[model samples]
Target: MARPVISCERHSLRGLLAVALALLLVCAVSAGVSAGQAGAQGLTPQQLAGQRVIYSYRGLTPPQSLLDDIRAGRAAGVIFFGENISSPEQIAGVVAQLRQAQAESPISRPLLLMTDQEGGLVRRLPGAPVPSAKQVGQSPDPVAAAFDAGLGAGRNLRGVGMNVNLAPVLDVFDTPGNFIDRTQRSFSDNPFAVAALGSAFITAQQGTGVAATAKHFPGLGTAPAGQNTDTGPVTLPADLSRLRSVDELPYPAAVFVGVKLVMLSWAIYPALDADRPAGLSPMIVDRELRGRNGFRGVTITDALEAESLNAFGTTGQRAVAAAAAGMDLILCSARDTGQGESATTALADAYAGGQLDPAAFDQAVARVDALRAGLR
Candidate 1:
C-alpha cells in the first residue's frame, strides 16, 4: 500500500499543495509517526526489538538460523559482504530465498537487503559505479559523473534483488593522504563540491528505486593518518567550528535531496560529546544530524562489532547502547547471526525493563516500517 500524501497547505491549496506535502512527508518521516505506525501497534517486545536488528552471516549460503529468524519476523534485514556473495546469479538465488522467508513474515514489507556498493574498490559486487568517489568528484563534470555512478549503482543493486546501497560517502576530507582521502572514499576537500556531488549521486541512485545511505556522519573527515574506527578506538578532537563548517557542511544538502538513511560514525568527537562515540551520542544523532540538519530519515550505526567498541561490552550491550542513543538499526556486521540474535534479545530486554522509552522505540520501529514499506 502507498503512503497517503495529504496536503499540509493551510491557505492556498492549489499552489502550495506539492511543496507542503513534500515538507510534511520529510517532517513526518523524521518524527517517525506517519509512515506505518499501525503495523507496529501490537508487536511483541521481542518482535518490536527484532525489527531494529540488521543481521549478517559468513560464506555464500545463509544459515538456517537466520532464515528461521526472518520467517518468525524476528529479523529486520540482512547486510551482504563480498564473502556472502560469489556471483550475481548466486546472490540473486540467495535473495529469492530470503524474499520467500520475508513473505512468511508478519511484517508485510520487504526485507532490507543491503551491501557496501560504493563506487570503485569499495564495491562488493562486480559492476557499475566502477569509478571511485575521488574519480567522480575530479571528473570534468563532477555532477554528471556522480549521477551516472549513482544511477549505475542503483540499477546494479536493484537487479540483484537488493534494496539498499550503503554508499555515496559524503565525508569531506581536509588533508591529503588522510584516511578518507587515501582510500578514495571522499569526493573533494571542498564541502560545497562534496555536497553537490553527494546530492546528485543521492538523487540518481534513489531514482532507480534503491535506497542510498549517506554515511559516517556528522563526518569522518577529521580522522587523521592511520586512524580507522573499524580497527580500534579513534577519537577526533576536531574544533567545533571546523566540524560544522568543513566536515558537516554537506549534510544539509544531502537531507534536502531526501537521502533515505544516514550512517553515523563510530569515532568519538569530543567537540560533539566528550564521552561516547558519535553513533552512541544523542547529542550528535539527535542534535547535530537530525535537529540541526533537519534529516527526518532513519539513522543507522556503522557496525556493532567494530574493535573500537571493545570497551563498550558485548554485542548485546553495544546494541542497547546504540539504540538508547537513538540509532534505529542495530547493524550486526560480524558475519555471525548469533551476534544479531544477541542484539535482538538485548533490545527486547531494554524495552521491557524501561531502559528504552516505549514511545521512542515505537517511533523507531515505525520509521523502519515506513522505510521497508517504501522499498516494496
Candidate 2:
C-alpha cells in the first residue's frame, strides 16, 4: 500500500522523542561505567604494593627501567643524590623528565622528587641554602636564622621542581663527632633548642610548598661514634624515660609544625624495641611514631638496603618487613635500579599471599595517597 505523508508537527514530535530516548540510553551507560569504576576504586594488589615505594637510579638521566616502573604505577617517587646532579639547571631538566613520565602514567599523581638538602655538607644540590643547621643553631637568633634558612632551602628545592626536602635533621647533636654532628647535620645538643629551631625550619619549608622530613627518628645522635647504621648496625642504649625525654623530644615539636614525613632510623633503639631496628620495628613505627606522637602524616623508612637490615633479609624482604611494620613509604636508595622493582614485587607478593594485614596495608596506602594528593 502507498505510504501516507505524515504531518510536519507529528514528524518533529517523533524526532524529539527519539532524541530523548537516545539521551536516556546514554545516561544509563555512563552511570554504569561510573559505577564500575567506583567499585574498582580500591587499589589493586600491585598498586597497593607499588604506591609505598620511592626508588633510585644510577645516573643523572631517568633510566628506562624507572620510567617503565612509573608508567606501570610501580613507583611512588625518586630520590636524587649528589651524583645524580651536576648543576641546578641539569637537575631541573632531570626532574622535568621524571615528572613527564609520571604524568603519562595511568595513575597521574605528582611524583615526589626529593633530596637531602639539609644544607651544609649534607646538601645534595650545590650552592648554599644559606647557613647550615649548625651555623643557624649557633647564630645570635637561632630560630629566625633557621626560618630564613628553611625558606632559602625551600626556594632552591622548588626551583629544581623537587617537592620534598629530606632535611632539618631534628636529632639533637648528642654524640659529638658522631655521624650527624661531624657532618653538621644536627641543630644543637639541647632538646629545647632543637625543638624551637627545628619547628621553625619545618614551618618555613612547608610554607614554601616543599614538605620537610624529620630524619633519623627517635634520635640517632645518641648512637656510638663511627657506628653508622648505613655501614653497620648500632644500638642506642637509652632507657625508655630518656627516650621519651631526649630522643623523641624534637619529633613532637616537628609534628606540631606539621612536618609531612618522618624518616625512621635503621639503628636499633633498645629502649623502644630491642629486637628490631626502628625502621622495621612496629613498636617504633606504628605505636610510637603513629600512636604515641599522633603524627598523621607519612612515615618513611631509612634506606631499605642499609647495613643495619643486613641480618634481617634481602632488599625485597626488608621492604616487605618495613611495610608490615607500619611504615608508609619504603625507600630503596641503593645503587641498583632493580632493587626498586624487587621491592615492589615483594610487597605485592606479601599482600597477595595473605602475609600482610589488609587493613594495615589499606591504611598505609591511604596515607601515601593523601601525601601525594597534597602535592602541586
Candidate 3:
C-alpha cells in the first residue's frame, strides 16, 4: 500500500505533540543550565539555520574556524571521534573551550557535545559500558546489564563534559552473523527483548544527565552482513507489517522512557518510502515516526557525508531536503569544518529563499532548542 501524501506540519496530532514538546523542554539534565526556551526568536535566518546542524572536526583539537562558527551562532553542537580525544581531561578541556565560545553567542544553552559511545568496540571514549549490547542480552541478567551499560555510558560521557551518547542500538536482527549481531550491536533478535533492554538503558542513562540516542531507525536489523551505509546505499525491503511489528517495536518503549534523540538511517526502506532514505522521507520521518508512533523528540540524520547520499546531490541540497522532510538536526561528521559550513549555508539559503515553510521551520528549530534545553 502506498502512503498518502500529507504536509509535515499538518498532522492531526498537533495538539498532543505541542504538549509533548513542552514536556521535553522541562526535562533538563546532565550539566549546565537550561538557558534555552522553546523558541527561535531574535535569530537571523542564518543563525536559525545553524541551530539545526551538528558539526565535527578532525584530529585532537577543534579548529578555530569551528569555534568562530559557534561564536557567530552558526553552529548548534558538535560530534566527537576517537581521533579528537587524547585523555578524558583533554576532551573535557576541549568541551570547556567550545562552551566558552557558545557563551559568546546569542544561543546560551549547552552545545550538544556527543560521540558514538555505544559500548565495546563502537565507543569513541576510553571507558565504561565495557560490555557490548549483544553480550548484555546473552548474559544471565540481561536487564541488569542493560541498565549498567547505560549508567556507565552516561556517567562516562558526563564526566568528560559531553552531553549525548549515540548509543543503545535497538536494532533487532533476525540471524547470527548479520551486520548488527556480528558487531555485537543489537541486544536481541526478539523485539520485546530489545524494547525492555533499550528502555532500561534509556532510563538509567538519562537519569545521569547525559542523553542517549536510539539509533538507525526505523531499525537497521535487516542490513546485510557486509553492507555499510557509510560507504554506500543499502535498501531493506521488509514489508510494512514486519517493519512495524519488529523494526519499530522498540521505539515506543524508548520514547516512553524519554530518549532525548533518535538517529534515522540512510538506508532506504521500500515498504515505507522507496524514493529516499528514511532520514529524508516525509512518510517515514513525519508520518511513520511522528504521526504513527508519536516520537516528538529531536530527529537527527545518520551522517551527512555518507556515500549513500551521492544521489541526493551536495550537502546543502541534502540538508534542505532533510529539514523539509521533518528532521531537526543534521549531523555533518566528515571531520571537515568546511563540510559543516556548506551545510549551514545551504540551509540558511533554503530558509531565506522560501524553500522551507516558515511556521514549520520555526517549529523545527524550536524542537532542536527544546532538546538543547534539556541539556546542560
Please give the TM-score that candidate 1 achieves against the real structure: 0.91
Off by over 4 Å in 1: 1-38
RMSD of 2: 18.5
The order by descending lDDT is 1, 3, 2
lDDT tens per residue, model 3, 158-237: 99899989988999877566567778999878787787678777777888888889988999998876777888999886
How should the candidates be ordered by TM-score, best one leading?
Answer: 1, 3, 2
Clashing pairs in 1: 30-296
- Model 2 steric clash pairs: none
**Model 2 misplaced stretches (Cα beyond 4 Å):** 1-43
- The lDDT leader among the candidates is 1
TM-score of each: 0.91, 0.88, 0.90
Local distance difference test values of all predictions, in order: 0.84, 0.78, 0.83
Whole-structure CA lDDT of model 2 = 0.78
- Residue by residue across 1-376, what tens digits does model 1's lDDT show? 1222333322232323343234334432222224456387677888889999999999999999999999988998999999998899999999999999999988788999999998878999999989999998777656667778888899999999999999889998776676787779998777777776787777778878898899989888878788789999989868999999988988887777678999999999998898999999999999998788888888898989999989999999999999989899989999999999999999999999999998888888888888898885
- Which 10 residues in a row give candidate 3 its minimum summed lDDT? 1-10
- Report how far residue 165 has shifted in candidate 1, in Å: 0.6
